[model samples]
Target: MFEAMIDPTAGPSATAAGPPRAGRPERLDGLVVGLVANPKKNAEPFLDAVGELLAAEHGTAGVVRTRKTSITDPIPPATLDELVRRCDVVLIGVGDCGSCSAAAVADGIAFEGAGVPAAVICTDAFRVSADAMARLQGSPGYAYVTTAHPLAPLDADAVRERARLALPELVELLTSAVPVAAR
Candidate 1:
């Protein structure tokens, strides 16, 4: 497939290696959850579940969850800029689809360049083996979830409701999710 052909190239890494390394500012107090949902049947479910999961994982700091307008296209520049300005971390849903995965990676790069610290690009766990997922996770740069663990395996209504309830927690987790290695 074309995705297999396009080298991952470590799309986005955690902040930067080592101590604050000068230039970049320290992490932020509040974090905005950037949910890059691919336009797909399952995108809503995955994103909703992620919002809920993050909230449950963290707390209410800040959140800016959104979905891509199109599955084939990268996020709009304005949206990307706004996401960077408003969020410290981002999570892109791979939705068990290759095209969605690629779009997530692209969006991640844009967010990273905008100064977002960590970007979690979710991929299909079933499609890619656990070992491959681990390799992607261990890659020099970029934060990845290759396990194909969809945040929402259940119904969309349940996922969205759950996300709404956990929005606060998600915001908190995004701030705390800083890679310990970076610190």
Candidate 2:
């Protein structure tokens, strides 16, 4: 007779996809924009570029901008609250701030608690190099994830052009789960 061995440590393997989510799908709408920047200087440039693209290409209704002063720090709760209150959708640019970008995903979750649609923007390198960055970072808290391929070394014009090309997809993805009128 043989008995199956039971390992106490045996369980489901940890995955990069992070957590499982289930809920009613939401729809996108034209409302307000929440622009977030990482601690890097280029973050602002990226945010500005996306904002312009969203406005010009997507016809975003309004705009709100916020940036984290330090990469190690979370976006301030007060600021997140303001963003939740002010905007229907938020576009958060992580730049090269990979870890900080992950944390920002958590911040987006916090904003979602207050009812705001949010997206975290990062260079494709980070997403492609570490596909788990968004997955492991994103929890049930955030609205969605938007990965953008930035021009190498953070070229402003290139980023702007890329934003123009990608903003529509980001807008559609971010707001896909949450309606503009809900907030």
lDDT of 1 by residue, 11-53 (tens): 3236433222112223433445667777766666656576556
lDDT for 167 in candidate 2 is 68
lDDT of 2 by residue, 16-88 (tens): 2334322222443366888888667567777788777667766767688877776545577788878877887
TM-score of every candidate: 0.57, 0.68
The true-versus-predicted C-alpha distance at residue 174 of model 2, in Å, is 2.3
Measured by lDDT, the strongest candidate is: 2
Where does model 1 exceed 4 Å of error?
1-29, 125-141, 149-183
Q: Give candidate 2 misplaced runs (Cα > 4 Å).
A: 1-30, 128-152, 178-183
The candidate scoring highest on TM-score is: 2
For every candidate, C-alpha RMSD to the true structure in Å: 6.8, 10.3
lDDT of 1 at 68: 67
Worst 10 residues of 2 by lDDT: 1-10
Question: CA lDDT of 175 in candidate 1?
Answer: 44
